[model samples]
Target: TSEDSEPWHIYTDLGYYSVELIAESQNCGADTLLIDSIIHVLNPSFISTIGNQDISIFPNPVKDKLYINFNKNLNNPMLLNIYDLNGKIIAQKDILSVAPGILELTFNRNKTQKGTYILRIQNTEETIFETKFILN
Candidate 1:
């Protein structure tokens, strides 16, 4: 039999048995018995920290294509600006109409040195969100 909090015993018809105990407390009950198995409930909200902005980037150490997802529709034109660590603007693009969804941007890694760079996204009003990536 399986249980969330241990102290499990397995017995055979031949009179042989083995026991195992997990030194933890179960919130359900201390003396709860499991003839077969027990199921444990999980709270999903405790699994991850979901934020407000809800923007994400993938393939962090990106070589070419970088994708972004925005949680909400943007009122102003979104601006993407890429910069090297030295504060020099390498590339800039003004996205005219961005629906609330995922977007893709491609970078030529061949033109970029293998190092860390910063990607900044802003709106017409200059509210900015920044993320860092490495070229390898």
Candidate 2:
């Protein structure tokens, strides 16, 4: 309608998005416009604290397995844990220092429910990274 001069939209997932808008006029006919990668949506989860800037995760709203990637090679063994917002440990794994510095682990679907989770990656000394993510 004419009230849609300014419209709002919501994206349910994290990825690059393209938007297409078509305008019609009685005398001017119709015109179409498309914008590629117009809206880039990221994980809506809130990260509490991050000690390291080199760590990252993909495919947020993770299902079965969560992939963790380190931008640099690791020098120490790492401990990865997933916890609820209330600080309950849901899953934990010991990730030894490897050649590629990339770690992968599976989350049991029958164990944890869908919600926001905090991922804590640590070494023997201290916590290296902690970020919140959504689980599907």
Candidate 3:
């Protein structure tokens, strides 16, 4: 039920399930909180992949500009989103047009606090890739 001091992850078969979290104070009779949510799990096969697109992001400990490169012949537009460790979106871009070899994008870094962040690339329908990076 527990791993390292990090977040707890629960993986289950495809189904609708309700999960609850209980937090209690040190005092046995102290205040407690109950947090709950409904979780829906879809079959992995349904979301494994629709099309293949190779992606790469560089200058990980980026100073100003974070560059992203993609490899594939994509006709439809793709969206790139960057999020801070707290899951807040910090930057986003839509690749409106490109030829059939590779596409590249750059996000300007300004006043962004130094920390870890997540990079996600997706289409309107599904998320294709996600990775982590650092800002310095």
Instruction: Give one digit per residue, the lDDT tens place, for model 2 in 1-136.
Output: 2336665443557899898888989999999899999887785344455888888886686987888878887779989898986789998888777455567877778887777789999999999998877777
What is the clash count of model 2? 0
Regions more than 4 Å wrong, model 1: 1-52
lDDT of candidate model 3 versus the reference: 0.62
Least accurate 10 contiguous residues by lDDT in model 2 = 1-10
Which candidate has the top score in lDDT? 2
What is each predicted model's overall lDDT from 0 to 1?
Answer: 0.63, 0.78, 0.62
For residues 21-72, what per-residue lDDT tens digits would candidate 3 score against the true structure? Answer: 4445567754534444476667311212233446666766676667666565
**Runs in model 2 lying further than 4 Å from the true structure:** 1-45
Q: Estimate each model's TM-score.
A: 0.56, 0.60, 0.53
Best by TM-score: 2
Models sorted by lDDT, best on top: 2, 1, 3
Q: Between the candidate structures 1 and 3, which one is better when assessed by TM-score?
A: 1
